[model samples]
Target: MSALVDMNAKSGNLERALKLFEEMPKRVYRLSKFSGCSIATLLKVCKTTEHLHHLHARIIRKGLEQDQFLIAEFITLSNSLASLNYSSSVFDRVISPNIFLWNSLIRGYCQKRCFQDVLSVFIRLKRQACLPDNYTFPSLIKACSSLCNVEGGKSIHGSVVRHGFEACVFVGTSLIDMYGKCGHIDDARKVFDEMTERNVVSWTAMVVGYVTVGDVVEAKKLFDAMPQRNVASWNAMIQGFVKLGDLSSARGIFDSMPEKNVVSFTTMIDGYAKSGDMVSARFLFDQSLDKDLVAWSALISGYVQNGQPNAALNFFLEMESMNVKPDEFILVSLMSACSQLGSLELAQWIDSYVSKSSINIQQDHVIAALVDMNAKSGNMERALKWFEEMPKRDLVSYCSMIQGLSIHGQGAEAIRLFNRMLTEGLVPDEVAFTIILTACSHAGLVDEGWHYFRSMKHKFCISPSPDHYACMVDLLSRSGHVKAAHDLIKSMPVEPHAGAWGALLGACKLYSDSDLAEIVANRLFELEPRNAANYVLLSNIYAAAERWIDVSLVRNKMRERGVRKIPGCSQI
Candidate 1:
């Protein structure tokens, strides 16, 4: 039975092994019949916390609780299966732990991103007089790096020197990485310079460190000076140039590389996408032999960002036809494209696909995109349902819901939700204030609008942007405050944007104030020379007042400027 259990566990058949283990006692074969290797195999193949607990109890009943090797293996495996607390509880009961046991627990903590606990354990190790080996400082330094605890990292570096492990190549590389990540690139370089020997990783760490600090010049110098180069080093240089918006330079490095991988292609593609060069982005994407999900996402989003929503959807179809499952990011991009197109049919298809697919509906970003898509598609009820179903409402989700309400002219509900967001302790940013102010304009909430507007710069210290000014103008105009709206536009500290003028002009048309309409229209003509709506609005204003000659002049202005009115379309 013991051999059968071992065989089943080794074959990755947890159900059979667990069933056989449960039947072991009835067969008169105790757990002692299982070797430590056999027991370790069971630990490795544990399917759940329940199975782990049952196995642990059996190991304890067999008097192997203090078996150091078995306990170490359990802690390591538990890092992946159970929680770190389980590993901590198991570690606490060990009477005399060797260095291997200490390192295992520290490694588990590091893996779980419990950086402060790693420091706590290292402190305890010092008090216990257990000498740390070369394996010790790497995880400890990594903990410090993750926490950005440069002081702690420096202290650990001193200990590494005292323990004579500073000369170890692996330890030196970790120190270099730690210093680099912590924005102490000079210190990283110093460590690299002092090292008697360095590997490709050590050199790459230094290059990446320089890239992190935006010192691509020095990074390129180091890249040129390296005795050898790997794909990581090449990718780092490409990323540096791409970040600085120097796509030409990035492409230059990419073209010079002897080898190119998915990362290299993805970085360059993203650069071209951001620079609005979708032709180059698509060209590179098609040229790459290895197209991963990230590469596909980059190209799809690039098309969407470059104002090619149909292209994004088409590529998404291509990816699906090729058997590539879309992840959350790609799904979010698709939702954005559908929202841009304002296609209720496409939005419904995306919603249905999400329901039938493996994507997590509970994911916050995916849910947020779904909310936006449904709202833009004119399905407010579905948008509200998703908003209320969010497991945890983040600021982005709140903004999405509030904007949905604003666009649907449910301004009162938008204001209520904005207040709810405040009550829940989310401080509104510039984007939130802009959306809320637009809601006020749409719903004609003047006093509430001014209150939030003043609070933006006075209470939250967020200066009102041009969009805020435009919303305020629209709000006053909608309320028959034409003179007040014009005054506000004139007093704007920043240059009044075309939106502010457009709002006031709209009011002129509404009130048939042709004189002020002509003035606002002339300014808009200078600002947006090719805007057919501005010329048409001005012409309509003149026509409404029976000024036939002035209306002809406005139409002639459109002809002179060669501005053509785009025919409008309606969704079914």
Candidate 2:
């Protein structure tokens, strides 16, 4: 029986080992002696949480829960569980855990982005006087990076130096990453430069750090100078170029690479998608080999980004038919496509799947996508419900819900949600303010709009960005405050953009202010002379005020400038 259990464990045949355990005679074999190893092996075979719990109960029945090795194995298994709350409970029960057990919990917390918990565990480890070795710093550093805790990370770095693990490859890489992520790019660079021996991971970490901070030029420079380049290095540089809106550079690198892997292909595809060159992206996607989930997601996201949500849906269907299992990313991408396409039926189907499957869609980003999808699909009620259901909501979700409500002419509801978001202590970004202001404009909430606009800087500490300014201009202009809107634009710290002038011009036309209209028209022409719409709009305003001479003058100028109005074309 012992030989059979050992063979099954070695071969990873947990079922056979379980059957052997059950069939063994109690009188001949001592069950207590080998229960820990057998239970660990059994837990590995159980894939679902339910089965894991069942096996855990069996381990308790065998009185193996107190064994240190068995507890370590259980921690490892819990770490593999995707749901944070479920695994967190298992981690809480481990009695007097060792270094391995602590590391397992830290890794799990890092995976779940439970940074506070990770820090708590690190603090507890310190209190226990558990001198951390090389294995300790990576997860600790990862937690600090996730939390953007530069001070905590620096303290950990001090500990690493004191413990003499600063030179360790994994520890060094993680420290570099932590500094880079904490907005200390120079420190990140210093760490990278000081490393006596750099591995692929260290190089990749540096490149990724540059990319994260939008320093694509530095990232590219490092990519060129690296002595060794792996798939991750190539992916990092390609993704960096993509993020910088250098699609051409990204494609150049993609072509110049000695080898292309799935990540590299996905990066290029996403680049083309984001740049609105879906045709090229689709061409490359079709030519690629072994389309994995990322490849499929890239294509789906490309279609959604390019406003061809139906195409994205079709590709998703094709991917399903090809037997490629959809991951969280794929589902989120598809959900976004469905929302953009206004396919409420599809969004409903996805919602059902998310509930039925054990997928962790509680991530704030994913929930944002879901909310955006539901709202864009004209299901504002469901969108609001989903927003309310989110376990951890962020500003993006709130902004999305507000925008959805505004689009559906439910500005009051949007304002309510925005208030709720503020009450919940989430810092509203400029985009969130813009959406709320737009909602006020749509609902004709002039007083509310002005209050929110002022509060943007005074109360929220969010300075008005270009989009925010645009929204304010639109609000004032639409509410018949054309002069006020013009004054606001002139008072802006930065130069008002073409859209700002365009908004004032729209208001001038509304209020029949030919003098202001002409001034705005001239400014618009200088800013965007090729915009035939601006000339036409100014001409229409003159015609409305019965200023035939001015209308004729505007028309003559448009003709003399050879600025032809683009023919409007619509596709069904």
Candidate 3:
């Protein structure tokens, strides 16, 4: 019976082993001798924490807890509890844990993102004279990587080499992942190159490392050079291409693959959706043979991203009709869709379902989505209600409320919210400033816009991006200050983009300033010659000033360039 249990445990057939253990006749010597491995296997088979506790009590009643092997097994079970971030009662009960027990706890803490606790436990283990083995460094490195602690990671790397496990494949892979995550891509590459043998995981680690750092070109180059490609390798490359906004290239690769798995399909669908090519995504969705939860989530997210919130909601209904349970990710996507479509009724229904179902929607992303939805639905009162209800508030939630207020022309309210964000000790980011600047621009608050733009660099230490410059130009131009706007453009530290030039041109037409209008037209033509609107703008300016000859000359240039202006019309 003991041998059968051992074999079943090794083979991961815990159910059959547990049944046999229950049916075995009660024998004192047999229970004493086999209780350690039996409890270990039972714990492995146990689906719930209650079952694990019950088995632990049985082990103690049989005096198996005193056995060194049983004690190690108990520590392993405690580590499992830590994996779920549950109570530490099992850890408290362990008498004198071995090196394996200490390593298990460290690994569990690392997995739970308790990096500081992992380090403290490591210190305690060293004080107890339990020298860390090969298993020790991987979890330690993983903790450092999660914490972005470069110095701690390097110290662990030194310890790895000292222990003669630097060449171990698992250790090397963890080191590569650690360095890459810590922004030491060059060091990761060095480790990859120096390793004599490389597996799929090693290659995937490097590829994903480059992808994480936004080095898509390098990721693609390495991906193509790989001798073998697995599902993860393909998924990594597809995800990398998606990040670069090269959905066409991602599709090309997806189409060329010998096997079209669920992940590949989902990645391509998401890529198309992100690029605003929902037509292609829906076509693929219809043709897919196997649709899983991830595929549904990706499609729903795509709809939300493309501003078709109604379609996203309809799909969510379809997903439920098909008996697919909605996870937190799906709920978040659905909530965002509700917000985009301004479907307050649907948002309320989702909120109610979240509470009743006890779904773990505790993430800031979900809370922010709810806030944004309420704001979009023109329910600022409800939006604030949800905002205040969040267990933990992050920058995204603050930005969402600010954006909602700005969009509704409540510039003062938006600024007030921004002030509140500052009062809460949360530093504003580029998006936060962008929202405030937009509110100022829409409210015709030119001075406020300027102050915020300057504060972006001086107060927040964030450099003014092109979006900020564009907003400032709109604020200046809309106030009938075309020449001032032009001078601001000229004084800009960076070259003005097409959007900035276009904003100035629109203002020129509004104020009928022929001199500045002509300058803006010329700049627009230089930037985008194929834009028929530029020639049309110049012709209109000529006609308005009664310069028939100049207008005729502009029309001739338009004819020669094969530029045809799109006809303006109103639907309603």
Q: Which candidate has the top score in lDDT?
A: 1
Clashes of each: 0, 0, 0
TM-score of each: 0.84, 0.64, 0.68
Task: Summarize candidate 2's per-residue lDDT along 1-572 as a digit string, tens digits.
Answer: 76786678567776677678667676543456566666666766666676567666776666666576677677778777546676656656767767877787777887777888888888998898877789988988988898889999999999999999978988999999999887799999988998887998899999999999999999989988998999888888888888889988888888888988877877787788778888898898887895677778888888877888888888888987887778888888888878776777888887787767666778877778889988977788889888888997877777878888898899999888889988999988777787898899899888999899999889978778777787889889999999889888888988788988898898898899989999899999999988999999999999999999999999999999999888989996
RMSD to native for every prediction? 4.4, 6.7, 6.4
Q: Which regions in candidate 3 have their CA more than 4 angstroms from the true location?
A: 1-64, 81-261, 264-290, 303-317, 334-362, 388-399, 418-434, 446-562, 570-572
Q: Who wins the TM-score comparison?
A: 1
lDDT (tens digit, per residue) of candidate 1 on 1-572: 77898899989997788777767663343434455566787988887888788778867766677878899988888888899989899988998788899999999999999999999999999999999999999999999999999999999999999999978999999999999999998899999999998999999999999999999999999999999999999999999999999999999999999999999999999899888898999899899999889889998888889889999999999999999999999999999999899888899999899878889989988999999999888788888899899999889888888888888789999999999999999999989999999999999999999999999989999889889999999999999999999998988889988999999999999999999999999999989999999999999999999999999999898899899999999997
What is candidate 3's TM-score against the reference?
0.68
Global CA lDDT computed for model 1: 0.91
lDDT of 1 at 399: 88
- Rank the models by lDDT, top first: 1, 2, 3
Worst 10 residues of 1 by lDDT: 26-35
Query: Per-residue lDDT for 320-416 in model 3, tens only?
Result: 8988888888988988888777766776787777666656666777777778888877778888988998998888898888888888889888888
Give each model's whole-structure lDDT. 0.91, 0.83, 0.81
